[model samples]
Every structure is written in C-alpha cells, then in structure tokens.
Target: MANTTSAKKATRKIARKTAINKARRTRVRGCLRKVEEAIAAADQAAASEALRIAQSELMRAVSKGVFHKNTASRKVSRLSKRIKALSA
Candidate 1:
C-alpha cells in the first residue's frame, strides 16, 4: 500500500502508462503479424505493402518509447530482407 499521497498518485500514473504501453505493444505486434502472414503467403506485393505499414508502426512505437530504437530497426531490417528475398 502507498503510505503517502505522492506515492498513490505515482501508482495511478504508472497504471495509466502501463495500460497505454500495453495497447501500443499490442498494436505493434498486430502489425508484425500482418507482415509475417503476408510473407508466409508468398505474395510479394502484399508483403511489401504490409512491411511498409509495419515499418511505420514500428518506428512510431519507438518514438513513443514502446520499443527500443534498435529493436525497431532490427525488425524492419529483417522484414525488409525477407521481402527482398521474396523478390529474388
């Protein structure tokens, strides 16, 4: 239990932030899943488009601090590489 008023306020704030972060994380995961599904289907065009949207969502999550910058970059790199491989 929070002993001070400040502690209670901080707890509330943390809860709110946690909920927001969870939502952002869920959305990012959904975007990644979409890209993977497109790639698995072997549809280069759809994969490319999904990758584009996923990249944007990933970077946005990074900007919001939901994901580390390097993590987002790595994901985008791997996805792009896969998409390129599909074309080749």
Candidate 2:
C-alpha cells in the first residue's frame, strides 16, 4: 500500500501507463495476426497489404515504447521475407 500522497499519485500514473501500454501491445499483436493469417492463406496480395499495415503499427509501438526498435525491426524483417517468399 502506498502510504504517502505522492506514492499514491505515482501508482495511479503507473496504472494509466500500464493500460495504455497493454492497449498498444494488443494493437500490435492484432496487426501481426492479420499478416500471419494472410501468409497462412498463401494470398500474396493480402499478405503484402497486411505486412504494410503491420509494419506501420509495429513502428508506432516502437516509438511509443511498447516495443524495442530491434524487436520491431526483426518482426518486420521476418514478415517481409515471408511475404516475399509467398510471391516467389
């Protein structure tokens, strides 16, 4: 339990931030799932489009501190490679 007023305020702030972070993470996951679904269906066009949207969502998460830059880059790289393979 937070004994001090400032500590209570800090706890509230953390909870709000946590909620925002969770929402951002969820959004990123949903975008990635869309890409994965397109890939699994072997639809090159849909996969390409999904990857585009996922990439943007991923970078946004990175900028918001929900994901590390390298983690986002790695995800984008793997998804792009998979999309390219679908076309090939």
Candidate 3:
C-alpha cells in the first residue's frame, strides 16, 4: 500500500535486492553443504578443495553484504580446523 511514487519505487528496488540476495545466500549455502559433505565422508583432499571454493564463495557473499565478514571468517576458520584435523 505504497501511495507515494518514491515509496513504490523503493518497494520495487527492495524486491529486486531481495531476489539477488536470496540467490547469493543459496549459492553460499550450497558451497557450505559441499564442504560439509566432504568432511563427513572423511575425504581430506575433497574437503580441502571444497573448503577452498567455499571460502571464496563466503567472502564473495560478505562483499555483497549477504554475510558479515566475521561470520564468513568464522566458517572458514572452523572448516580449516576440521580439515587440518583430518591430517592428524
């Protein structure tokens, strides 16, 4: 119920941004899932590779404002720790 023209335009802009951010979030989740799957399967090499890709996707999301930098960093750190533990 946006009566003002500017308000209508803002609503449209918000919808567009929502769609884009949703896609980005989905992509990031997919990457994280891949890493987790690799880890669960205990495949060190695959986990490492997946983590590499996930790390980049996470940072990309952070840059796009889909995720906070610290959140992404924490995810990357935890994944790295798990991957390293596989070596032991």
TM-score of 1: 0.97
Enumerate residue pairs that collide in model 1. none
- Candidate lDDT scores, in order, read 0.93, 0.94, 0.96
Structural similarity to truth (TM-score) of each candidate: 0.97, 0.97, 0.98
Instruction: Please provide, for model 1 over 1-88, each residue's C-alpha lDDT reduced to its tens digit, 9 standing for 90 to 100.
Output: 9999999999999999999999989998999999999989999999999989988988998999999999999999999999899888
> Any runs in candidate 3 off by more than 4 Å, and if so which?
none
- Per-residue lDDT, model 2, residue 31, is 92
lDDT of 3 by residue, 1-88 (tens): 9999999999999999999999999999999999999999999999999999999999999999999999999999999999999889
* 1 against 3, candidate with superior lDDT: 3
Q: Using lDDT as the measure, name the better of candidate 1 and candidate 2.
A: 2
Q: Which scores greater on TM-score, model 1 or model 3?
A: 3
* Local error of candidate 1 at residue 6 (angstroms): 0.6
Give the TM-score comparing model 3 with the true structure, all chains together.
0.98
